[model samples]
Every structure is written in C-alpha cells, then in structure tokens.
Target chain A: MSRLSINQQTVKQLSLPELIRACTAVGVDAVGLWREPVAEYGLVRSAELFTSAGFSVTSLCRGGFFTAADPADRRRAIQDNRAAIDETAALGAPVLVLVAGGLPAGSRDLRGARAQVVDAIAELAPYAAERGVRLAIEPLHPMFTSDRCVVSTLAQSLDIAEQFPVAQVGVCVDTYHLWWDPDLDAGISRAGERIAAYQLADWTTPLPAGVLTGRGQIGDGCVDFPAFTEAVLATGYTGPIEVEIFNDELWKRDGAAVVAEIAARYPACVGTAS
Target chain B: MSRLSINQQTVKQLSLPELIRACTAVGVDAVGLWREPVAEYGLVRSAELFTSAGFSVTSLCRGGFFTAADPADRRRAIQDNRAAIDETAALGAPVLVLVAGGLPAGSRDLRGARAQVVDAIAELAPYAAERGVRLAIEPLHPMFTSDRCVVSTLAQSLDIAEQFPVAQVGVCVDTYHLWWDPDLDAGISRAGERIAAYQLADWTTPLPAGVLTGRGQIGDGCVDFPAFTEAVLATGYTGPIEVEIFNDELWKRDGAAVVAEIAARYPACVGTAS
Candidate 1:
C-alpha cells in the first residue's frame, strides 16, 4: 500500500478526533476532514490532535456553494471559502474540495446558475492561489444539476479550471460522482496530472432517492476500479486511492468494523498483487 | 398546428380506443402509437380508427430493447423491431423510435452491453432503412443507465448512428434526457438533420419512483426549453416539438384537457414566432 486516506465522509458517524484516533489505530496514512467535524472538535484542538498523532490531512471537505440570488450572500460564500482555505492551510491539507452550489431559489435557469459558478470560481481562484490552497472542483452526478451543482461533467470542470491559471485550480475526480460519464476516459486524459484527488467508490444500481448519501463501497457494485485506476495512473496521478463511501447501511455499522472492512477491500480492488 | 401527435403513453390511464377517441375530440393532427396500446386496440382497428379520424400516424412508441445475453433473445428483439417497423408502415408513421435496452440481467459490464447495442442497431438499421422507416435512437436520461439503455449520451447515440450508411438512422433529442449535458451544443450540431424527433419536458428535483413515469410537463420545471429549442433548430431540425411529459399528475387529468394544456404551453417554449 502506497498510503491509505479515509475520507471523513466514510466515517461520518465518528467525531473528528475519534475519526483521527480510529485512522491511527488502523495504521491508516491520511484523513480527508470535513468542515462540520472540525467545527465540532474545534479547529485548534482538531489540528492539535492530528499533529499529535502525526496524521496527514489529505484534503478539506468543502468550500463552494457559490450560486446565490443575493450579491451579499455570494460574497459571504467567497469569504467562507477563503476561511476554509485558511483552515485547510492550518491543518496542512493540500487541497480544499469545493461542491459548487446548486441553483438559486426558484430559478430554473441552470446555464445562468452555471455562469454564477464560473464567475464565483474566477473570483475565488486568485485568493486561493495566494493562500497556497488548491481549489479542487468536484463534479457531482448530473442528477445534482438542478440543486447541487451546475458543473455536472469533468470536461466542464476542466473548462472551468482553464479560466484560472493551473497553479491553484484543479479537479477532484470522485468516482462516485463520475462513474457513469461516457466521456470519462477523455475527461481523465484531459485532467492528466491536473487531477488533485483520486477518490474511489462503486456505483450501486437503482440509485436510492438519487441524493448525496446513497454511494456504495468499492467492489460492492459496477465500477471497473482496476480499469479506471489504470486510466487515472496513465494520466500520472500516483496519489492514494481515497476510499469515500456514503452508504447508509455502512454508517449504521460499527465504525471500527467499517474501517477494517474498507482497509481489507482496498488493496483487493486496487492492488497489483492478486 | 402542423401535425399534433398524441403519444399513447401520455394518457396511460385510458384504453387505446378511449385515447384515440380523446385525441379525435381534442383535434390532434396525428398519433404516436405505443405497442401495448396497439395490442389493445388491435393493429387493424387502431389503423382503421386513425384513418377514420383523419389523424396521421407520426411515429411508433418504441421497438428496441436490443441488449440481451441470449443470442436467440437478441435475434427475437430484431424480429420484434421488424414487426414494429411493419406496424409503423401499416399506420403510416415515418419514424419508429428505439429505446435501446440497458445492461443485461446479472451483468455489470456496461461497455460490453453498449457494444451489443451498436451491433444490434447496425443489424436493425438496414432493415428499417430498406422499409422506408426511419429508426430513431432515443438517448435516455443517465438515471436510466442501469436497466433501460446503455446509450446515455447524445454524442454516443450520434456516434452509433454514424456507423449506418443512411441518414434515416438518426436520434431523438428528448429534453428530459439531454438537458444536463454540458456538450449539448456540440451534440446537437452533430445531430443536425440526423435528428428525427425533438421531445420536450421539464426535469423536476427529487425524481419520483418508477422514474420512467415521473417526467414533468413542458414549462412545469427547470429546463430551458426555448434555448434548447433554438439549439435543435440551429441543427436544422425544424420538426414538430413533441411535448412528451410522463407525469402522474398529467395522466390523471382528462385527456382532452391535457392536450389543450400542451397546445397552450408548447409554442411559448418553442422557437420565437416570425
């Protein structure tokens, strides 16, 4: 194993400090911490705990929700993202994950909402660059187009990234969000070394409620992990394959058991050793 | 008013004969008949009723569930599509819509299933072309990728059609299926004159169960209809904008009233009047 990073979303059931302790106990290599969890543990204490355990914060979970009808709220969102970048920097995380906001209230114009995303990102990029924080735009599934994200395709994400200089802008290629894309290969090729994060999860059929929470664990469903991993590696992404499952069933299980199960399954799905 | 077609699916609650009478009462210009409706009304009587009511048969409501594991069943699917072509010919529909089948049962290889779809279409395209019936591949919503069709992208559908020698083998650009595509403009441009149908409906948030039947009526949700209509027209598709909503709410209404509502809403969402 090169290194294992458990996305905090996988063990969302655990507190941030508890999640860190759990990762250390399992001899895990890294953590992808979310905002709410950090707030719960208090950012200062959370940083102290990670530092004490010598844990690496691979990335911070989220700093974008840019669509807004009001300019004041939009500006506030940017400020919030800047703070998120500062927190990520303080925690020694390399990238700040961004879940671009859904449509403005009562707005049916996705293109218009998408424009807001572009403009917001363009404005945020320079500030993020100054802070030495890479803004990794994660393309959510198309089903989220109406209410979660306007950037539904990786190509679109890359296109959006092109507007800003490559130094501080890239994408988080989460398989849960992108497994169904027909242009996935081309998108990954275009992404190349610019892919800041390589997240993995299986896509279960008959999506439940078609929301953010129905994600499956690696090898539990249809994603060709070996093939997709090969494609990502071909693009020179040698990062840890971050396992980030959002299974409700798994959430209900014992956190330690889930972590062990994931640890066991990880190498089988992505390892060269058969 | 060029030619109004009542897709049998629009009034799924009513019997085929009842739907026919309702279409007649509402002064519909034509009928897009479904297989089940045809079976109920008897193909002979369905033809008789359309002829008597002076309604043109615009298209047949589907004939392709092509991806199958068994070679015999695959062959049977072709034969069934041939029958649909014959029924289309009998009822005088210029086009026979094809909803290509999805991942085969107990299979996770979508790529293999898609290859099967390409081969199946290649075989059936020739027969439909010879019979003077246009075979229109409807690129379904990505949400239907698991069990409905492997051809989820408009670009993919156009790629498949490019294999056939004739222009008659084309695509059906349904708004509900395609509105989320970031490469929509490029796909529409490629479709050009090869687009056989332009179906319209809005995409609602938190889609209902039996999602096949949960589509919203035109102008009822978030799709930019006028913009989409303009793009399709830009591709040289000046065909009738078929308003094809599969909503339970619309189905519960009187068939005549539903037709009236569509008639009132469509022109607004379509191209600007000269």
Candidate 2:
C-alpha cells in the first residue's frame, strides 16, 4: 500500500475537502488531482489541505492542447499551459500530465498537427523544468486521435519526450490507453526512467458513446493489471501508482466507497502483498 | 472510375440484387463483398449476377476470427476460413480480407492471442493460395484490439503476412484504421507489394456506441484522403481502391443515393480527375 494513490477523478463526485478527508479515513497517503477541481477549491488552499492531511499530490491532471490551427489560439494555449505548470508547482506535484490535443477543426493534416505538438512541448519544457515540474505527455488511445489527443502511442509520446531533457519531459504510461498496443511491453521498457507517471485503468468493452467516460474500475475490465504493473516496475519506477478510472457509474457512487474499493483492488493488480 | 470499387458494407441496407443494381446504375465497375449477404442470396447466383453485370469482384469482405481458446472452436474457424477462400475463388475475387478476432473470453494474454492469429493465418494461407485468392490481413484500429480484431497495426499485419508467401498472405490497408498511426507513412512504404487491398473511410468524432459502425463517409471527417492515396500509390499499389464506410446514419439512407455519393466522392480521394 506504500505506492498506492487514488486519482481524484476516480471519485469525481467528491469535493477537494471531502476527497482529502476520505483519503485520510481510507488510509490512502497520496492522490493525483485535476486542474479544474483544484482551481475551484482555490489552488493554494487545496495544496494546504492536502499537506495538512499528510497526502502527497502525485501529479496534476493536464496542460496541453497545442494543435490549434490559429496562431493566436496556439499562443493562448501555450500561455494556459504555463499557468498550469505554475499550478502544478504550487500544488507540490512533481508531474503535469499533458494530453496533446486533437486535430484543429476542419484541418486534416495529422502530421502537421503532431509537429505542432513537438514544437509546443519544446517551448514549454524549459518553463516546466525551471519551476521543478516535469511535463508528462500522456498518449491517449488511438480512438481519441481526432477529438482528444493526436499522440496515440507510447512510442509517439516518447518520440516527443526524447527531444527534451528526461527531467523536464517524460511519458505518462496509462493502461487504459495502451493496453491494446502490441509493442506496449517494449515501449514500456524503452520508456525506462523517462516514465514520469504511471496510471491504471481497465479497458471494458462496448465502449460507451463519446468514449470519454467509459474507463472501467481496476478489476472490472480486460486489462492485465498485474502484468502492466510489473512492466512499469521493471522500468525501475518507484513513484506512486495511481488508479484513475473515469466511468459515469463510478462517478455516481460515494467517493469514500470508491477510494476504499480502489485500495482493496490495488494489491492484486500491482502484485504487492496487502 | 476504373480503379474505384464500393464495398457492400458501405450500403448495408441494400439486398444483394438491389446493391448490384445500385452499383451498376452508379457506374461502379467493381465491388468488395461480404459473406453473409452473398450466402443468403446464394453464392453461385451472386457470382453469376456480378459477372452478368460486368462487375469485378474486387475482394471478399472477411475470412478470419482465429483466437478461440478451445481446440474445436479453432478448428471450426479454420474450416470456416477454408470455405470463405472457396467462396472468394468462386466469386472471382482476387483478395480475401481477414479481420483477426480478439482475445479469448476471460483471457488477458494479448501476446498469446496475437501469436494464435499468425498460426491460424499460416494454416489457411496455403488453401487461399491454391484457390488463387490472396489472404489480406486487415489491421483494425487499436480500439478494436480487444473485441473485433487483434491485428491493430499495418506493421503487425505485415509481421504475420510476411511469415507466409507474399502471394498467399498480404495486408488490407484501411485509412480509417491506419490514419492515426505515426508510423503509417513508413508502414505503407514497407508494405509495398504486400498490400493486397486499399480501403478508404474518414475518421469522425463522437464515435457512436459499440464503435463498430462509426466510420464516416469520404470527406465527412478528418482523414486526409488525398495524402493517404498518395502514400499507397507511392508503394506502387494500383489495385482497386474500395470505399468501405460503416456508418449507422448512412445505412438509414437510400442505397442508390449512398452509392452515387460514394462514386462522386471517390475520385478526389484516389487522386483521379473527375
């Protein structure tokens, strides 16, 4: 249980304060948080709340949408990401997960859009490194390539991350997004120390409409969690193992119950004795 | 127009006879067929109908689902594929597309399942070759890796296809599935003469439930058709370019209108002057 962390998204129904209290009661010592909820609860105050409860903020949710076609929109996105970097630093999170946005509206140049992502990250890496926050590029599943993130493979994310200093930019390995990858084991091994954050979510079928909130709980789907965890561990990563599921059904349940269930399911997946 | 072909699935609402009439009316010289409807309309009769109408059977829709755990089930799948090869030969189709099935139920050994696909293909490749039918392995999008197909990349498809003789086993390249791949350009180039069929379908957002029937018609989504066609052409593949969209909305419309629209949209995507 030393490495276990419950991502705030796993219990989206809980407020920041309620989340901290629930984690304390459930004996979860760490958490991964989202930008919107932290801002809503007041960034500094939320940071203090976590500190007071002796909880470590493992990572900040996101900070990239660099695929805008308009020059002005691209600049604005960069600015927004800089602000997100500051927030990550303020919250004492070591990593800021970057979900490289989808293709711009009406633009079919996927290669061009991906080039823009690399350029945007190069510009942001220095800012993040200076602030002591690592930018973790999260490669979404290929299904989200058009509408969400164009970085659809762990190798693609590494292609961008390798262009920057390892301490500044790294890849976020999430099982839900990469479970289908044939080269996943090799990709994970290649990620090595470049793995900034490791996340777990199961892949359930008959993917819900929109496919955004369809992630299953740890044990509910087909992902081989123990194998996935073993691969990440083989990378020599000793950081927090965050369970971040985004199911509509899970969101409706009590936050405390959700966290408790996650805690219970963590050991079997990560191969750690409970 | 000579190189243009319409897959039967693009206008699934039409019966075999109605589809043949609609394609003939639209001046589509070629067609890719599905097994179920062809069987329903009588395989021999369907072949005769296409031949009488001066239509070339470009490729047969499917012939693989070889990931079953049971020995009997695996043998049955191989037998079914042999029958499909016979149908492809009888229909005078040059290629038989294989959508490799996903992991066996309650199993999480993705690598093992993929290995099984390679073995199954090897078992059927000789039979297909004997019938002068090329087994075209279709690499479905990674999203379908768990449920629909395990061959989730053109490279993976080629990995298996290359194991057998190129004349016996090749690959089906569908823009909808491969467009998101960062390695697509290189994969297409590597595929070279191993590309047995070239398919076109755009990638639309807000994927409908099940994700199977969510493929968009040409120019309806973000896939850069001209670019994709150029890549395939660069590989020296001058085969029939089939338009195969699986859209629920399109299925609700009139079949003749759908074929007409497909014909109208086909030239621009394939780089042919209208």
DockQ of 2: 0.88
Tens-place lDDT per residue, model 1, B1-274, is 5634567677677776676677666566666778777877799888888788677777788988998889999999989988998888888778899999887776777888888888888887777777889999999987677678888889999889888864668889999999988889889988888899877788886776446766888777788887888888887676655667788888888877787777777677674730
True contacts kept of each: 0.37, 0.86
Candidate DockQ scores, in order: 0.52, 0.88
TM-score (chain B) for candidate 1 is 0.93
TM-score of chain B, candidates 1 onward in order: 0.93, 0.98
Tens digit per residue, CA lDDT, model 2, A107-148: 998988999999999999999999999999999999999989
lDDT of 2 by residue, B1-274 (tens): 7888989999989987788888888787799999999999999999999999889999998989999889899999999999999999999999999999998998888988998898898788888888899999999999898887999998899888889888889999999999999999989999999999999999998999888899999989999888888889888898998999999999999999999998887877766422
Q: What are the models' TM-scores?
A: 0.94, 0.98
Q: Model 2's CAPRI class?
A: high
Residue-wise C-alpha lDDT for candidate 1, range A109-135, written one tens digit per residue:
777778888888888888888888898
Q: Candidate 2, which segments miss by more than 4 Å at Cα?
A: A272-274, B272-274
Query: What lDDT does model 1 reach?
Result: 0.81
